[model samples]
Target: MRSVSIPDAVRCKVAAEPRVDAPHHPITLSFTDGVLTMEGELADLAAKKLALERAASVPGVDHIVDRLRVAPARTMGDAEIRDHVRDLLLEEPVLQPLARATPSLEPGVPLRPDVVLGTIGLSVARGVVTLDGIVPSLAHKRLAGALAWWVPGVRDVVNGLEVVPPEEDDDGEISDAVRLVLEKDPLVDASQLGVSTRRAVVTLSGVVRCGVERRAAERDAWCVFGVDGVTNHIEVRE
Candidate 1:
């Protein structure tokens, strides 16, 4: 297929999204073979996600390669920031219940102390937050990571929480779940895309009209119960 030159209207469309902070960082957009690449820095993850969403909404954009970085406006000492994050975790409504669960220990059976979401551990160095331990579900893990990022001085978050659900689904089940989600999502047309899974990794391929559908498909796949990774290979045919 011959690649179309990126339209100036598309570039204008992306640049016109509402800015998140006072001094907006520029996002450089480039196109090749219908894939639009967004590169540069933004104030935070929210802004980055918004930028990508805007890019996807453009009429002819197919796939988007996001290489945006998040840079916080201010910095705080590691100790103070760590304390703040710890308090946030302790106070989070969803995590409070999990935090209150008692650790179980049985004699002659090794105690897996790190098996609960409440046992999340946090450490900070040079503004980076490292979260480690176990969570009951992927939602809890994401909550911990989001809390870390929400802290004032956090530069980056390393979420190492392990999800140990009571039962695990096989690859086929995971694939089916992702496909169903894509089919149901208003933003994505599943008939125009392909979904496959192996070892919990999902690969989305085929063609879509714009970037939003492509990203919406990937986001839905990631939200599935057992998806560990998503490899989106869908092409934009617009």
Candidate 2:
């Protein structure tokens, strides 16, 4: 008897994830051999990551083709997005050394890259930003991806930044990205916001003038690349 039990099992596991199956999310799953293809719009970045994690946990699911998406902040051309990402990477004080190794946006050539750790190769095609290179730490890798995602026009981020020392990725990286997200958004006052992440779950606290600001702060938290969950603790004073 021909069997198709693996896909069924994977489906069950995926459905079991509340966030994946949430009313706001529309996910479509397909399986072929050991590869699972997940495509659709999740409520936010956390939901998208959680959905992929859920599908990969299934026994026979060896490779996952993630086509998940979150509602984009805005839309722009590839060139503009690439420039924004490049500028952010260069402007970040912590990432300055790594950014020096990044290729220049004008002619798509490396400008004295290979300075500190290794070179960062960047490209944007159809709103997807691909970053491939080596960084000194896992935090640097995550920070670069978060910056790419921070761009309003970026639809997806392919973070291939290898940590040379192979440090373990932890909650600290998530908190750092969350803090950067808050700081980048003009509507939210980062000083008034308390940012924290534990095991990939983000907790946004503090008070804002209106419910809109509060919601914006929470949404900012969800926009980071590696976030798994967001708990909004923001209060609206007005």
Candidate 3:
């Protein structure tokens, strides 16, 4: 028979995973005679369901004794949960635009006066923000809403952001712009793709066969407008 001992570092790592704010029951870890047992109460149903999963994720635990119970839902109302979520949502960068726009969501659009936030194109009216233009994903839309609500004068967010796929034309522009970048550097094959730019947004397309080539194309696009950023949709093929 073999005996096993738990290291303090490993124990500390486990404790840190579920923050103290998380509902937790007693958790016991033992490694004697080659066996490990874990017991704990989790904050709620979700935590209890996830306890075994968390245990399995740890590296050296060979066995577990999961007797953790899922506590009933806390008395805190839905409004409280929503408030907490709202605070968290406002903390993200993507949502900040919404907060800036919220005051002008109506009344023919109050122009965003700040250039940095204005680049995102936020408008406010009355007390809500009416979002416009394109967003890459649903996540951005939600962030916009959170930001609108976070503003002092904001009442709500009007999400008008359209989810559009990066345009094929944009790809062509990207490729061409990348080609230009390569040409200027004298270190890359500039003829591989046709690239172009609009409003500091570089678009790339065409065939880049390797990761290195693709990255190079992207780097070129980025150099043109250091602050505006690049969109690389170059296809990789052999």
Best by lDDT: 2
- Over 4 Å off in model 2, which ranges? 1-26, 41-47, 57-62, 101-118
Show the colliding residue pairs in model 2: 101-113
By summed lDDT, the worst window of 10 consecutive residues in model 2 runs over 109-118
Model 1 bad stretches (over 4 Å): 1-11, 20-23, 29-39, 56-67, 70-73, 77-80, 91-133, 155-162, 166-238
Give the Cα error of residue 215 in candidate 3, in Å: 0.4
lDDT of each: 0.67, 0.75, 0.47
* Candidate 3 wrongly placed segments (more than 4 Å): 1-179, 225-227
User: For candidate 3, lDDT tens digit of each residue in 1-238?
Assistant: 8543353433554566563223235565656553556555555333333444455556676666544443323433323333333443445565555434344433455333311232244444433345566666444543444344333344334556654664333444443434534554433466676565664455666776687877766644543311143556778786
* TM-scores, each model vs. reference: 0.42, 0.75, 0.25
Error of 1 at 19 (Å): 2.7
Better of 1 and 2 by TM-score: 2
Residue-wise lDDT of candidate 2 within 121-196, one digit each (tens)? 7877777888887888766776778778778887778888888988766788788768876776778888888888
| Candidate with the larger lDDT of 1 and 3 | 1
Alpha-carbon shift of residue 61 in model 3 (angstroms): 52
Task: Give model 3's TM-score versus the native structure.
Answer: 0.25
Top of the candidates by TM-score? 2
